[model samples]
Target: MYIKLLYSAIALVACTSARPQQLSLSLLPPAQQVFVQPAQQNNAIEPSINAINKPTNPIVVAAFQREALLPPHMQNSFYKNPKIAETLAQNSWFGPGEQHAVNRETEKIPREKIFIILKNAGLLPTP
Candidate 1:
């Protein structure tokens, strides 16, 4: 099939070479020819930034609480499951960052990046 396609392309090029054609090109209009510019800038070009509504700790606390409510056997798997662990750690700024105070570790890896890596590795759920 590829050989036939290649042959067809070669035939097209060969056929086109047998004829001569002229093509017309046009130059762009000068700045003066363009529409008049507006004097005033748009009032609201960007959307306002707002803080996230839910605090991060409650979700983590909820997950732990939910796990505690589960049977002892299920609790082990709930906590240990990589997907659950990674989801609970979502950092899309996904959830809030670092709950506890920390001064050490100069280059802290964002949880979103960690979640991305785990998601790529099939350890976390992929959207």
Candidate 2:
């Protein structure tokens, strides 16, 4: 009972004495200014939206065409394939274990590279 009373008293004191953490922006070091030069304009004309959308890689273009031709029901099965799952896992920047599998930057990598990856894995045939 005495120990309990002591603990309760200690807890009360601790609670009463505790103060919220205070932060001031003035206390922080000044942020360094980084100046970026404006990008130079090129004389070359920009590609049209059609050209941008179109797959330049033959293998990717053929795969896309084949997928487009498939019925809606078949299209569902194509995406759900285990081989595609494995390929996605392999292509992902992060993996299950300690291995840093950021082999390719996800955003920057083209769809053609993914198609090529699938083709090399024997999931897709060469076009």
Candidate 3:
């Protein structure tokens, strides 16, 4: 029984080790050639070009203006310094009692940038 098992294993090994016959490409039909046509240049002016380049929405323009005014902390809060915020609040023309209000406004600056980023990334729903 052991000899029969060994013979069967050897037969299995021999079958597995045999090289598979490869198909000849020469025997197959020739592939058809494809020619691509060049794109035609249009002389007509585009209707959307002006609209795409122009800032029609005042709200979006305001948002961009506010983005430009925002401090560096809004984009990179990892390097945020509390001392800078306090200093800005102190130097502002607001009264001493309004220092906290100034600080709060400074803190709020990043939220606009954060919301814009999140909305652009599709992580936050747009209003």
Most lDDT-accurate candidate: 2
lDDT of 1 at 31: 22
Using lDDT as the measure, name the better of candidate 1 and candidate 2.
2
**For model 3, which pairs clash?**
none
| Local accuracy by lDDT, each model | 0.36, 0.38, 0.35
Candidate 2 regions with alpha-carbon error over 4 angstroms: 1-56, 77-127
The residue pairs found clashing in candidate 1 are 91-94
Per-model C-alpha RMSD: 25.1, 26.5, 29.7
Q: Model 1 lDDT vs. the true structure?
A: 0.36
How do the residues 1-127 of candidate 2 rate in per-residue lDDT, one tens digit apiece?
Answer: 5655554454334333322111111222113223232232332112222222432333233344445455656665644576885576457434456542223233343333333344344444444
Worst 10 residues of 2 by lDDT: 20-29
Sort every candidate by lDDT, greatest first: 2, 1, 3
What's the lDDT for residue 20 in model 2? Answer: 13
Residues 1-127 of candidate 1: C-alpha lDDT, one tens digit per residue:
5655554454344333221111001111122123222232232112122123344332233334445555556546654676775565454333346344222231233333333333344433443
What C-alpha lDDT, on a 0 to 100 scale, does residue 45 get in candidate 1? Answer: 19
> Ten-residue segment with the worst summed lDDT in candidate 1?
19-28
